[model samples]
Target: MINIPFNKPYLTGKELFYIEDAVKKGKISGNGYYTQLCQKYFESKYGFNKCLLTTSCTDALEMAAILIDIKEGDEVIMPSYTFVSTANAFVLRGAKIVFADSRLDHPGIDEDQLESLITSKTKAIVPVHYAGVACDMDKIMNLANQYGLYVIEDAAQAIDSFYTGKDGIKKALGSIGHLAAFSFHETKNIISGEGGMLAINDRKFAERAEIIWEKGTNRSAFFRGEVDKYGWVDIGSSFLPSEIIAAFLWAQLENLEDIQQVRIAHWENYHQKLQEWTSDNLIQLPVIPSYATNNGHMFYLICKNLKQRTTIIDNLKSEGILSVFHYISLHRSQFYKGKNFNTVLKQTDIFSDCLLRLPMYYELKVEDVIYKITEK
Candidate 1:
């Protein structure tokens, strides 16, 4: 039996060296030498105005919620097909979730229906770039401007991806919105075991974002000798990760180009091999919009229906290959039902029951598993 796991974290072979370097530097706490290096790398490479290293994408999103001053009774609009952390971050701040529907063709939020869900109580529009594909940013941003709402991009799966707007300019996925979050989970394109970052594009949030990231204090400024002393100045939490996590992430960052190239090659191979099934109308492949570039974060198939998807999973398991379904529609979850969500989420439900993720990683050997899926 040849058992293949769904995801195996890729290492660049310098993780321990950098971690040891951090330990030798005598600063393993957050915002140390390695942390600064990781943060600066993203800012310099991607053109983000500011970057803050956090423990995880969830923590980064929570920091966004706090920086935006989400309050009780405020409404946050986002797709119902996203991860819980996207909504939970705001829910913790007492915001009412206004669940949106996924697009008919892709799993990203439907940009056309975004404005209809807005109201005076709407505080922000959180767009989760599902599978690292960019949502219709122009339309989303226009709506945000018209309604005077904040756009917090949940770019959890969008590292190294891009969005080209109507102006013929290419913007990094996490650099377009007012604030954005990125994940460095073991399953993501880059791995830091458990890490993430917050990108602040809007200048207004720059100073305050650092303050909130440092446990609501001026410790960052104090360390730079800009402030006399550090003290609690606002409502915030400890969101920064230690230098060890940052050091591991820096190692991965150094090899980002190589990692992206190999993963994208794997993505193309799957697409080419699966075209027959898709052409026969037996399954559907991922839809990449013209404005977005694939970061090869994940590759998934949409089965004809729930029953068909189940049989595919069973068949894959019989071959000793692991396949799995993606997110359950948050609107239809046990938790969301308790909140009295009644709007129909047709597309979201379809994706919930039918989307099946194949094994995809930096080192995936596509030829080894191509036979099983091809036969079915």
Candidate 2:
């Protein structure tokens, strides 16, 4: 039996070359040449006002929490069917997380149900673009505008993806919100081992975001001759990554188009091959909303129930094929249990109990994954 791992990080052959070049430049600290290179690449491609590369998506979120000044007693609305980092980021700043449910046809936050959750204490809306699919950003942004709330997009699995708005104008996922975060973790579409980025669309936060990324100092501007002297200016941490990580990320970005094309082809192949099998088995495949474009970050399925999902996983593992389940709703987490924000989430719970992820990676053998899952 051929063992197939769920994810195997891909390299473009230039990772080490760039790392060597970075070392030769003699600066391994953050905000160095390779760091700027990656940042500029994203800014140029996505048209973001500014971009800051962080050590992880969690760091980016924490920076956003600080940038937005999420104080004690403030409320933040986000889907419960997401990674804990999404909630933990705000929670660290003493913000009360107001969890929302997932959509019936999709695992994304149900945009239609958002308005009911807003209150005078609501400060921001953090929408996780689950599986690289865009949440209903138009509704999200409209709500933010109406309620005067900030929008922080968790684009951890959403690189090179797009969202077409009502105006028919397509925008990059990370560029839609007031602030957006992207991950380049080894498990994602891109890999920098452990890395992420924070894109600033709202200009007000651009200058301040850099401060937060540079360990709460004005060091970024001070080095650029913008400030006479830099010191502890505000609250922040060591969010920015070193030149080595940036070098590895730069290599990945250089081949982004090629990588995206290959992953998308694999994604489409899986979708087509398993369509009949999934329907017959009472399983639902991933759904890409009309407004979203497939970046091929992930391909998952909705099993009938928790038992069925577990059975499928065991069957796959027996055949040397690894398959796994996703998040178990934030509200149901061990840490957050009985924290008083229950507010039953039907759709979120359903997804939490049934979502299964098959092998999805740059070098994945889609046929192998399909054969095992569809085998009688």
Candidate 3:
């Protein structure tokens, strides 16, 4: 039986050459030559004010939490239909997480409901670009400005995605947020085994970001000779990734356009083939808003309910294909149970029960997609 995985890291041939070069240079630690190259690529390509590669997206989110200065009892609003790290990062900073519902058409947070949740204690809004689909940033950003709230975008799946605002200006997902996090995990469009980056869009947070990423020390200042000696300056952590991983990441970044095209083809093929199921009322294909550009990070189908989702998932697994579900609505998770301050998450519950992610990766072939769909 030849089984297809839900995802597999696609490698560009340049990885070994870069890794060997890094090894020959004898600098494998964080922020070395290859690391700098990767950072510069993102900065130039994405128009990010500053880009710092982290050990993982989880680490980058934590770094954003620290940079935002989320404090105890401060309320942070975010959609519950997100990876736990999105909420856990702020929660770790002693902030109270207020769950929000997803929009009916898209799984991102409902911007209309966001304003009503704002209060004097509200500190920030984290919007997860679910499956690389852009959230309604125009509404979210306007609300953030109105309420004086910080916006941290969880763009784990939105590396190549774009949004055209109401004013006719096009912006990349990570660039629009005050601060954003990206993942290059094996399961993502790009791969570094386990890696991520923090995109600092706000100038005010740039300098402090380097120090915070380097374990709350002025080590970055010392390296640049801005200071005579480096020592602990504030609260921080070792969030930076190694140069070896950066070397691997550089290979992917070099061929990003080619990789994106391949994945986009696969995504569109799935959508085109499965669109008829919508009429049958068997499942709903992914809904991409008009303002968003496809990045080919994921392709999912919405089953009628949890029961149908479970049945489909099991059926796929039995057929030697792996399918999966997403976040379980953190507000209702075991860890958050009994927390009185949590808000109702109607859409989050619906998303959790209905959404099912299909196999999607840079190397997924058209035949494999056809096979999976035909099994239905």
Candidate 4:
């Protein structure tokens, strides 16, 4: 039996070199040379007004919630078929979560039904770009504008993905919304062991975002001599990542193009190989909209039902090939059961039951994954 793990972190060969250089700089703390390099790389590459590296995407989202001033009784609308962090960030700030359903074609939030979910209390809309595929940003952004709501894009899996609006201008995923969050987890396309970033596109939040990232202090401004001294200024936590993680991330950024090409090839291979299964209605493949570009973050199949998915997982385990299911619907979660959500998210529940993520990583051979997945 050939053993294949679900994910393996990739190293770009320069991680250690950059980390050693960071150590030699005599500053391994949060906002050091390497940290600035990683932040600048994203701001320049994605055209974001500002970027700040965080310890995790959760922290980034929390910072977004803070920047937007989510308050008690405020309602935040987002898909139920997302990681808990998406909702938790706002919930922690005392906002009420309005659970939205997933699209029938994809696991992203159902854009068509968003208007019906909004109320006077709706303060923001968080669109999660599942599987690195861009959500319908034009529609989502239009809704936000009409309703006077902030848009915080949950771009954890969408570092390099893009969306082309009706104006025919292509915008990076994180650059479209008022704010966005990204992840560089070990399982992500870009690995830094554990890291994330906050992209602030709306200039209004620029200064405050930096202060929030630096533990609610004006330290960042103080460092640039904009202030005489740094002190506790606002409500915040230690959100910035240390220089070592940023050093590792910079090495990955240096090789991003090469890495993206390989991942795209692997993603295409899976789509082609699984066509027959998908055509037979045995499972459903990922869907990419015309306005959106794929970032090759993940390739997943939707099983017909929970039992079939379970059988498939068991078969893969028997073959020594590891496959896994994704998130559960937050609306139906144990934590949400006692809460006051009246929404019936059928599509979200279906995805929670059926979606399965196959083994995907930078180093894994496409042919090996195809063979294991298609084996009778």
lDDT (tens digit, per residue) of candidate 4 on 170-201: 99999999999999999999989888999999
TM-score of each: 0.98, 0.98, 0.97, 0.98
* Candidate 4 global CA lDDT score: 0.92
Clashes of each: 0, 0, 0, 0
> What C-alpha lDDT does candidate 1 achieve relative to the native structure?
0.92
Error of 4 at 284 (Å): 1.3
Question: How much is the lDDT of residue 15 in candidate 1?
Answer: 97
Give one digit per residue, the lDDT tens place, for model 2 in 1-376.
6489988999999999999999999999999999999999999998888999999999999999998999999999999999989999999999999999999999999999999999999999999999999999999999999999999999999999999999999999999889999898999988999999999999999999998898889999999999899999988899999999999999999999999999999999999999999999999989888999999988899999999999999999999988889898888877787686557899999998999998988888899889888885
Better of 1 and 4 by TM-score: 1
Checking candidate 2 for backbone clashes, the offending pairs are none
RMSD of each: 0.9, 1.0, 1.4, 1.1
Q: Order the candidates by lDDT, highest first — what do you get?
A: 2, 1, 4, 3
Over all chains combined, what TM-score does candidate 1 have? 0.98
- Which sections of candidate 3 miss by over 4 Å? none
Model 4 scores a TM of: 0.98
After best superposition, candidate 2 residue 143: deviation in angstroms? 0.9
Worst 10 residues of 2 by lDDT: 334-343
List candidate 4 stretches off by more than 4 Å.
Answer: none
- In model 1, which regions exceed 4 Å deviation? none
